[model samples]
Target: MTAQYDNLATLESWNDSFKVSPHELPGERQMRARRVSGFLRARQAELPVVPAQEAASDAASGIADAGRKTAQIEREWVSAQWGLVPRWVKSEKDAKLRAPKLLVALNETVSTTQAFRDAWLAGQRCVIPMQAFYVEDLRGGKPVPTRIARVDGQPMGVAGVWECWKDPQSGAELLSYAILTINANNHALMRRYGHPGSDRRMPVILGEGTYDAWLSARQDKAREFMRAYPANWLLANPVENKKDKKPKGLFD
Candidate 1:
């Protein structure tokens, strides 16, 4: 329910903070890295390469350059949309907007309820990568934008559900994702930094140990794992907001 957050950094910084292995990179990151590589290949083909005396060295350097570019593009893309969706979704527009709002609530009652059951049954566990997240805080009479991040400045993953949907009109496929929410564990932080409204729900912050089980455990197990972690495990800080000079980070 709180809105103000301070940690905002590139996903690479987050990866380093959490000690996330390349294999642990979320599916969204892989999709983006592939897209960047694809674009670079297409561009490279369009622009002829110069003949070099050190062909092997040139090839290695070219590969490194491509990786740097891909990493940059991946960072930008992930920063813009780090949230997840169901793999079946064909496009964001084709996704079901009702029930859980993909940006905040993790669809515990709708898609996620089913997704948790399905993922547990299928034994397919997953993780969501987030550098920082925005929340709305009520201040005086207006909402403020707050960026919430880990205290150690690590990128964190909230439990998530992805859905893939097909467009009936274009027949294109799209993938979307949602975050799960539960009652706030940090009441003091919620009152001091969260939205002033009575609604104080928060995204379920999963521990590293529980992530795999939450992603791949059976339905019963996943449900048990969905419980919230201790409030002290998370650190909330005040962030700047432009809407109000003294505005808490809650709204734009």
Candidate 2:
């Protein structure tokens, strides 16, 4: 997939579609690799859930944790860079140079990939809300920008992982995220996009019912929701202009 996409334009849509309050509106509607955009993630207070039996055992042994509580799994919208910056990065300059190449994490190796391993194992999964994602169709011999959205026209909640990095020099924290992609070589629709000979891949689109569940799932169980979105449910339309690759009629 390309390093660009479109996000929710209005506050009401962001609130209704993702069911969270964004502290600030996005300045840009179209997002590129390192742009700051809003994403939904479960509140950290309830993450890494403790099993009921484990909590009960601790309580009986007089070792109950004071901060432990039943899993409420609250979600919040956070403004983070679209490209993930590993917490281990040594410098801010290195982060800027590395963000673009780290835009998408392969689902097959996300758990083991060096750049994403810390965030993945820390249960930093998130949902990226977008109106649609852009790709280039080269079937016609030249690149033609294409807009890929759901057939129903509703917003899509894409699966991703988030991270927070601290500038070792300035001590400022940077929040960022990366979309998780799966092999689309066998997909009937997605296979038509991207480069001609390279392996096909697409973002992991989650179902409406699984948004909260995805954020609450344990690290090991998160992969269960990494299935590809149905090709028939998606609609792809050629953008009018390659340079100004905005969705037709909507932004005008």
Could you report the Cα RMSD, in angstroms, for every candidate shown? 15.0, 7.1
Model 1 lDDT-worst window of ten: 34-43
Clashes of each: 37, 0
lDDT (CA) per prediction: 0.42, 0.84
Quote the positional error of residue 172 for candidate 1 in Å.
Answer: 1.6
TM-score for candidate 1, residues paired by index: 0.54
Predicted model with the maximum lDDT: 2
Candidate 2 local accuracy as lDDT? 0.84
Residue 84 lDDT, candidate 2, scale 0-100: 92
What is the Cα-based lDDT of residue 112 in candidate 1?
42
> How far is 35's C-alpha from truth in model 2 (Å)?
0.9
lDDT of 1 by residue, 1-252 (tens): 422122324436545544333322333433221111000000111222333444334335532222112211111112122233444444545354431334334434633454344422343334455555556666655655566666765556666454444566677654444455666635555444454545567766666544433443323334444565565656655466555376566565
